[model samples]
Target: MRNGLSTFWDGRGFDLLLVGIPLAFLIAISGSALVYNVVMSFQEVGMFTLGSFVRPFAGLKNYAEVLSDPQTWPILGNTAIFVVGSLSGQFIVGFALALFFGLKFPGSTYLRGLFLVSWVMPGLVTGALWSWLLAGDFGVVNFFLRSLGIINENIFWRSDPAFALWSVVIANIWFGTSFNMILLSVGLASIPEDLYEAASLDGANVFQRFFTITLPMMRSTIGALLSLGLIFTLQQFDLFAALTDGGPNNASNVAQYWAWQLSFREYDFARGATVSVMMIIVVIAAALFYVRSTRHEVRG
Candidate 1:
């Protein structure tokens, strides 16, 4: 018994133990939950059956019903807009800030570090802060717009249907921009300085060198960043909960928030699970893309 124990510790058993622990944890926790959720999506789950593992088999009825609902398409549209708007705004602003900081100006590092304050804050907190800022009556956003002569009156950002979705989009941009900046900064830093020097010697202008060298080199990083952005944006529920709650007549409604509303608020668990399953599919695709991009970057 003592020899066996010693062999187990000294041999491949230790390596297997390390790998097996996390694998077991993943299977026990995340894998089981995901499987249960997927199964629930295909079953008829009600208040009465919520606690039970066995429920009436629903087949594809949940998916069919969720798809047929009028709100589904519009909410999905809103989600697309949110994802695109947030990702675009975050990437553009982040890339610009990264380039600016890459110049290595004095205090640039300190200033860059300061921007991480937004990324470090909780999503709900950021949403609440934005809620105050976007208030129609006494919000700072309205005040600033009025000061800039950009508008004649307060915009009612959170309540008005026309702008409610966009209000969240703006806040999301601010919340995620710093993360994008930090990652993009790392990408920029990874680039070889010799390429830039050689390009300069070849009489390439700033724009030429940027287009030919910087962009090509950062392609993998951008792909990974965008994929991660897709995943994060899809999972963004806190901001919606805090700011809009999918309210103002569901104008700002997205899949994640709608799923919660259906399951918890409306007590339609099957439909909610259906929405979640759909989102899980999308998220899995994005995760795959992120993995592929990372692999390509590592190989490069």
Candidate 2:
């Protein structure tokens, strides 16, 4: 026992032990939940059966039913649109801000810090604020667009099928940009300054240096960022609840929200769990990629 204690203190086993503890805890809590959810997806789960685990087994009927639903495809498509739009906007805008702040002008740090206000704000609060801002009548967005001659009339951003999804997309982008910026900023900081100096000495312009030096160095960080962003975007529910509620004939409904509606609103717990299982399956790939990216990151 004394030798085991000494070995733990002296050997790398201690590091393994530290890692294993949290992993065990995660499997105990999250793992149990996931296993139960999968079981519920296969078995029949309802309000009355919620107290027991010995519910009727339905096999793949729940999965088949969920997949066969007409709303399934459209909601999944909206989810795809939301994920793509939000990530694209957030990363592009965030990368631009990261590059701008990388220049290190006076007060740049303070200014960059201020941008985190968006990150700190609650998602529902952001959604409510955007709901007002994107309102068709008397909205600042419509007024500005009209003033700038960008639009001839007010847009029913939330209610209109054409713009409903995009409204949530826009809000999500603004909500997540700060987080993206912070991660990209750290990635930027980690890059060797000497590489840029050398590139500058070699007559490389700002654009040239960024493409060759900045991007190559940031590949790992970008991978990790995209993976995490995918997970977050898939799990997103609050903003949809606050802003669109999958309105205008399910035009803006996504898998997460739809699953919730089935589970809680419609009391189709088995189908809901099936939808959730699919989401988890989709996200697991991204999570694995993020882990792999971190493992393969270059260290100086």
lDDT tens per residue, model 2, 189-262: 99888998999999999899989999999999999999999999998898999999999899999999999999
- The Cα error of candidate 2 at residue 164, in Å, is 0.6
lDDT of candidates 1 onward, in order: 0.94, 0.93
Candidate 2 versus truth, CA RMSD in Å, comes to 1.8
Task: Give RMSD to native, each candidate.
Answer: 2.4, 1.8
TM-score, every prediction: 0.95, 0.94
Candidate 1's residue-wise lDDT over 1-300, tens digit each? 987788678877788888999999999999999998999999999888999877999999999999899999999999999999999999999999999999999999999999999999999999999999999999999999999999998899999999999999999999999999999999999999999999999999999998999999998899999999999999999899999889799999999999999999888899999999999999999999999988965685
Best candidate according to lDDT: 1
Record all residue pairs in model 2 with backbone atoms less than 3 Å apart, i.e. clashing: none
lDDT of 2: 0.93
